[model samples]
Target: MLTDTLRKVDNLMKNKFTAILVALCFCITSVNFTGLLTVSAATYGDYTYKVSNGEVTITGFDDSVSGAITIPAEINGYPVTAIDKDAFYGCDSLESIEIPNSVKIIGEGAFRYCYALTSVTISNGVTTIGEEAFEECSSLENIQIPDSVTSIGQWAFYNTAYYDDETNWADGVLYIGNHLIKADRD
Candidate 1:
């Protein structure tokens, strides 16, 4: 009877240890992923932004404020380093924008479908313009893309006046600075 009782205790202990280990693993994963996915956001002036790694990323805009949208170099003391995906999506009143030199990454569809947007002046520090960043900006005709851009996502300038114009093409492709935005011929 004693032997049988000792064996039951041993099995019980092992099961409890296994349960504890599984619980600990789950807690560790939750802590790590929470830090990565739970970004705190704040509003500064016309921008709603998030801060990570001491830099600010613009995530949303106050659509009521329109025309000549000048993205500031910094927000609330942190340097504005990026623009989030779909940040200004469908802000039809936005007529123009000058992406400041502090910004490096422009997220996918960042300025997509801003129908009234007619001009864009990307600063020299910008490196990547995300997919469909300016897609469907029907009025967009004037733009100055700096040589610093290394990657531009597909349809970044599609449906814009600049993309539709043959004068902006070389032979068949629309080359913006040294980056090939689209190819047109046959």
Candidate 2:
């Protein structure tokens, strides 16, 4: 009877030990995978924020130079696709901007407060212009909105030379169709 009882105890211990090992393995796998996912999320979209041309790359601001800045059209054989929010914000000396046809989206506040910005040329294929995209550009004079654009968010060009003068839409004309949205002088 004693021998039988000992065998039962041994079997019970073996089963419990196997269950514990399985649980530990599951916990380790869960923790390892969670860590890997967190790292991926942090680095997923980090590459789309800067402008690079292999020969010359520009990002954020140009504290060394005080005058005009020209972002490259291509970077490392890849066409420039995105200009991050505030990429050129507060560039007071920026007199003009030329966005290439390769660009698809201009993030919020991308060109905010370019006090000296007078000319802007947006190339084809751009579909969306984010809010405050060109806000507070007081000196901006000529703006060409491509027909490919479908939506213009609120305050996208607010407090700028385009909308500052309510009486004169001549200074700024939103080009949508083959026609322009202008004031009727009738």
Candidate 3:
């Protein structure tokens, strides 16, 4: 009878040990998977302002920023294709900007309300400037829209100050390679 009892006890202990080991392993696996999910959420959640050729598209600007900003020529190794509407709106201290040739389009209000912007150099590959692209850029003293662009949207420079003096402008008529855009409104 004693031997029989001993055998039963051993069997029970073996089963209990196996159950504990499995439970510990399951707990560890759960913790590992949870940690991985947390890392992934954090990485994808933070603010990443950019637009790329295939992966991401920038739509607009959400906050005000000061100082000059040099938008990266590429994002995630893909060339930047578009500048969305209001992309640099309310950036009061933005003094100058260089739009790279890789950018094909500039959306509406892209530089609106940039009060301190004094110069802009649009590269030769851009094709379109959307409506009100530079609206209210009061301090924008000089702008050179390249010859490659074919379309300038309505009111692109509405409510903004432009070259009142010869030194502030290259010509009385804003010319994109002999295609006159406008005459300074008296």
Candidate 4:
């Protein structure tokens, strides 16, 4: 009877150990999967960026940043080549932004819904502006599209105060070296 009781106790301990091991594994996996264990890339000034293949992409910004924000041309030896989707979305206190010449692409909704944004300086190297890149910027007064910009996605400047109908844009139209780019409705 003593041997039987010992065997039962040993089995119970083994079961408890197995359950604890399973629970630990699950917790670790959950943390990694939910990004709680991932480390963010370096932050420069008010911006955070991630680098891959020797290129940098702006990811997020510090919420306390107000007024004009200037994106640096390079961060940590990598050229800032792109702005990720929703990089500056809904930053209501940001009044303006200056994108450096190293940036080539502006991702979808990069600057959307910045209600207080009024001006933007897009340098000469940018080629593509993604969909809704500057949509819903009610206070934006004007923008100058550089000649290097080859494509402007749909609704990029929708709902802005400066938008005018494409055909009736006698004034307040986005221009690239005299070529009309967008004349969105106000």
Candidate 5:
């Protein structure tokens, strides 16, 4: 009878140990996945950036930043080559932005939903503006795309006063390098 009781107690302890090991593994996996999501991001000054291949990409702006923002040409001696996806998403108080000449790419949704953004000055070195880069910027009136730009992605400026169908701009048209980009009237 004693041997039978000992065997039962041993089996219960083994089962509990196995359950604990499985739970521990699950917890570790969850933490690792969460770390992967935010691992590349690091804050510098008012921006969160990621550095890869000797270049820096501005990943996001600090929520406290307002009004104007001027991205530096370099961060920690690495050229700021790109503005990463959703870099300035939903920054409603941002009014204007000056992207320096060293930047080469503007990632998808980089400036989307910045309702108060009015003017954007993309300097001469940028080559690509990613999809929906400036979408939903209701107040943005003017943007001068430099000749160096080779690709402007789909809906890059959608829902802005410059591209929306409802509002008629003073010129009643929007032109991109002598090509008709958008027009409200004939």
Candidate 6:
């Protein structure tokens, strides 16, 4: 009878130990997955970005940055495919910027109110330039729109020196490459 009780106790202890080990492993695995999600949210230089479906989108920038900046084609091994609205808005000190070939879209007002922006280079992979993308870039005098761009939103270059310059117009129209920008109805 004593041997029988001892066997029962040993069996109970083994079962409890196994259950505890499995619960502990589950907790550890849960914590590890949570940590991976947090780690995925990262930054590239002064650019705030997010990754989704294996693509990266630049969402914002450091307001204090000055001079020229080149948006990297990839951030943290993910391709930078888009720029969010207002990403560089109010960057008064920015002089120039280059959008890499991996980017496909430029969100609305991406560079709005950048008073000191003078030059912009858009690579060939871009497909769309959003509304008010370069609005109020008062000092922007040089910009290039590649053939890959399929659309430009309303008021994209409003108030920009490039748009205001008379020499940039041909006949009664302003054009960037082969894309018709505006018409001088006057």
Highest TM-score: which candidate?
A: 1
What would the TM-score be for candidate 2 when compared with the true structure? 0.60
| Candidate 4 C-alpha error for residue 36, in Å | 27
Give all TM-scores, in the order shown: 0.78, 0.60, 0.62, 0.70, 0.70, 0.76
Q: Model 1, 45-163: lDDT tens per residue?
A: 88899988778999999877778889999987789999999999999999999999999999999999999999999999999999999999999999899999989998899989989
Model 2: lDDT of residue 58: 28
Off by over 4 Å in 4: 1-40, 164-186
For model 1, the superposed segments whose C-alpha errors exceed 4 Å read: 1-38
lDDT (tens digit, per residue) of candidate 2 on 124-171: 877777788888999776778888877666567666675665554554
Shift in Å, residue 107, candidate 5: 0.7
Displacement of residue 155 (Cα, Å) in model 2 is: 0.7
Clashes of 6: 0
State the lDDT of candidate 5 residue by residue for 63-174, as single tens digits: 6578998999998887899999998999989999999999999999999999999999999999999999999999998787898898888778888877764444447765
Model 1 earns a TM-score of 0.78
Least accurate stretch of 10 residues (summed lDDT) in model 6?
A: 32-41
Clashes of each: 0, 1, 0, 0, 0, 0
- Relative to the true structure, how large is the alpha-carbon lDDT of every model? 0.91, 0.65, 0.68, 0.82, 0.84, 0.90
lDDT tens per residue, model 4, 6-116: 999999999999999999999986664433232348788888888776788998887667898888999877789999999988888999889999999999999999989
User: What's model 4's lDDT at 164?
Assistant: 40
- How far is each candidate from the true structure, as Cα RMSD in Å? 4.3, 7.2, 10.9, 8.1, 8.4, 6.1
Candidates 4 and 6: which is better by lDDT? 6
Task: List residue ranges in candidate 5 displaced over 4 A.
Answer: 1-40, 165-174, 178-186
What residue runs in model 2 are displaced by over 4 Å at the alpha carbon? 1-59, 63-69, 170-186
Worst 10 residues of 3 by lDDT: 38-47
Lowest-sum lDDT 10-residue window in model 1: 30-39
